[model samples]
Target: MKQELRKQFGDEFQYEIALNGNEALEVVDELVEAGVNVILILSDWLMPGLKGDEFLILIHAKYPNIRSILITGHVDESAAERVKREAGTYAVFSKPWDSTKLMEAVRICCNKN
Candidate 1:
């Protein structure tokens, strides 16, 4: 995924991939251990092992300061409602996303960090 993003966004953007939530959490923990403060998290909502919204919930519980954005290809109304009702997400984007707007949103959110 990062490879594709690199190809698409070039050197202006940085990216990292985590095969699962544990790995992602490890990376986040390590960054925190390094005394770095991160602000934005962009996650897919249908990951294996842990659902994306659930992962965001966990992250919110542990790191309430960070802002999270969730992307989902799923169109289930109930799931959307659940995410909106239960999670502290910055935004929920559906599949076939608008790259320009997404990057703009990232830039806006990242500027605060």
Candidate 2:
């Protein structure tokens, strides 16, 4: 997925990867301190430490302007609804997602910011 994103967007955007939710938050803090405008986040539902929805909610609370896209192999309807409501999730994709749709969504989110 990372390779696909880079191939699709090239150097147009700076992409960062984190091993887990905590690391992701740290990266976000560093980027914020560096005056980077973090417009979007793409997260997996399952990861070490905080779950993706939980992490997105936390991020939304701290950085409301940031939009998020969630990729999950498994998530319940209620959880999806909650993230959409509380985290301002821009999109959600299931596992084995269509590359075209994912890229299109990314493009839309990037353009919005």
Candidate 3:
């Protein structure tokens, strides 16, 4: 799925493949160390090892400059509200996503001069 998006975007974007939350964090850490500027992050809410909001919290603690969009279907409204309050989530999407809206939101979030 993401591969197709990468193909569509071409050199306008780059991607890192990670098997899980820990791996994703490791990749993020490396990017931060290398001074790579990521304008936005879109992450799934449910993942092995850590929830999406939890992982985003960790990333936010370290890299507050990055914006985050969370996708989830495993939680209720109360849980979503709590996550938004506690985790600084920029936006949330329900599962079975809409690709057009997602891409538009991505562009809005990642816009640079």
Which prediction has the highest TM-score against the true structure?
2
Give the lDDT of residue 22 in candidate 1: 74
- Which ten contiguous residues of candidate 1 have the minimum total lDDT? 1-10
Candidate 3 on 80-100: residue-level lDDT in tens? 776577767767888877877
- Against the true structure, what is every candidate's RMSD? 3.0, 1.4, 2.2
Clashing pairs in 2: none
| Model 2 misplaced stretches (Cα beyond 4 Å) | none
- Candidate 2, position 75, lDDT: 59
Query: TM-score of the candidate numbered 3?
Result: 0.84
* TM-scores for candidates 1 onward, in order: 0.78, 0.95, 0.84
Looking at model 1, the pairs that clash are none
- Better structure of 1 and 2 per lDDT: 2
Q: lDDT tens digits, residues 1-113, model 2?
A: 78998898788888999999999999998998899999899999899999999999999999999889999999577878899999999888988888899889998988932
Please give, for residues 8-110, the per-residue lDDT of candidate 1 as tens digits: 5576644667877777788778877887776777888888788888887788778888777778898666766666566667677889888766766666666
Q: Name the lDDT of candidate 2.
A: 0.91
